[model samples]
Target: MKILTITGYKGGCGKSVTAIHVATYLSALGDVVLVDSDPNRTSLSWANRGQLPFTVVDERKAMKVVQGRDFIVIDTPARPDSSDLKELAEGCDLLILPTLPDIVSLEPMLQTAHDLGEANYRALLTIVPPKPSREGEAMREELRSNGVPVFSTMIRRTAGFQKAALAGFPIRDLTGRDRMGWLDYDSLGSEILEAIGR
Candidate 1:
């Protein structure tokens, strides 16, 4: 099984949202479980209310339950300490660090990447503006210039995300105006699966 941890040193970077959406997409391929490591239990609460297709469990029993699963998408806490980050990285196949296209988010993301020390990780741009601004592209360039591998697919900022979270539905399950949000995550899921050769 591949353990994919969605983490960042800062909060409000779409970590839980990415974890839920990605887990939903990956579920189509194989058995996928979302492990909520955040003390707030945001993803677990959403799962409990939304009745997501896959299972949702707390961190306490995550390792044991993920033994035979195809993917373990972990929603980690915000701003984990260095030791905690190290422990979380252990045995993880991929570390997905989602960041906003701003200096505040990018700075900490870079620091977190440096602390991890050569682990398999990729930085994903989240909350990008919908009007095709250069901000997202610029942020990707900045990260790449700093030696951080970044994903070309970026999660755009949309009310659809908030709607999905509030209604307990995956972005892909939404219809009408909110449905466009699924495309970004779908691209991200495809890239991740391809990168890992799954």
Candidate 2:
């Protein structure tokens, strides 16, 4: 089984949202187990309301339940310790860290990546505004120079994501081929799968 863990040290960086969407996408390809390791149960609530086909396991029992699954996606809680995060990372074939393009998001992301050490990892840029502003390209370059492996795909900030979240469905279904403002995550899934050789 290929395990993917969505983890971050800070909140509101699209951690839970990324977890749900990735799981949904993976389920379309094969058996998937979505483990909401976050104590807040953000992903769990969305799965419960949406009635996703994949199973949801509590963070406490995730390791055991993930044993025989073809794929496991771990949605970690915000504010997780480095040691605890490392434990989760050990099981993942790849660690996905989603963060905004701004400093607030990048700092924690960098820290988490360092904490993960040799764990296979990549960063998905999220919450990027559509129109390029003064901080856009520069920030992207900055991330690359910092030795962070960033995906070319980016999730543009949009109201559609919130709407889809409220309706309990994947935004890709709502946006069709247009990307629904999440350009990065749309292709990011494929990049992640390719990285782990899955």
Candidate 3:
């Protein structure tokens, strides 16, 4: 199974959201289980509030739930220490680091990449302002120049995401423009699959 872990040093960077959506995208290929490794239980709470295509279990219960799973998406706790981050990187097939486009968020992300050393990982820019704002692209280019492995697919910030979380549905499962956010993840999912050569 391809195990994917979503982690970040900062909170509110859409780590849990990205984890859920990615798991939803992977479900198309095979059975997927999302392990809520985060102490906050964000993924587990969302699953309890509504229906999810895949299973979501707390880390404590993950061993049993992970059996026969084709994909395992882990939503790790925010602010893991350097040593913990290194361990997390070595343990997962691909480490996904989601961060905002702003400088405050970038520092931790860059540090995370550094702490990961040679581990397989990619940076995903989340909550990117749409249209007139060029922050997302600008930051992406900057990261590339700095030798950071960032995804070309940037996730635009939208209220649709919050709605999805509140309703316990994947962004793709929503109706109308609210579901538009799914497009970003669809592209991201494609990139992730290719990154891992799956």
Q: Kindly give the number of clashing pairs for every candidate.
A: 0, 2, 0
The best candidate in terms of TM-score = 3
Best by lDDT: 3
Q: For residues 149-177, what per-residue lDDT tens digits would candidate 3 score against the true structure?
A: 99999999999998999999999999999
Q: What would you estimate as the lDDT of candidate 2?
A: 0.77
- Residues 51-155, candidate 1: write the lDDT tens digits: 787999998987678888998899999988888888877758888889999877777878887888887789999999877588999999999999998899999
Which residue runs does candidate 1 get wrong by more than 4 Å? none
Q: Which order, best to worst by TM-score?
A: 3, 1, 2
In order, the Cα lDDT scores of the candidates are 0.88, 0.77, 0.92
Kindly report which residue pairs in candidate 3 clash with one another.
none
lDDT of 2 by residue, 53-154 (tens): 578878777777777788889887877788987887786798887777887776776787778777788887777776846354556677788887777677
Candidate 2: where is the Cα deviation over 4 Å? 60-65, 134-136, 175-179
Better of 2 and 3 by TM-score: 3
TM-score: the better of candidates 1 and 2 = 1
Q: What is the lDDT of residue 196 in candidate 2?
A: 89
Error (Å) of candidate 3 at residue 175 is: 1.1
Clashes of 2: 2
In model 2, state the lDDT of residue 169. 68
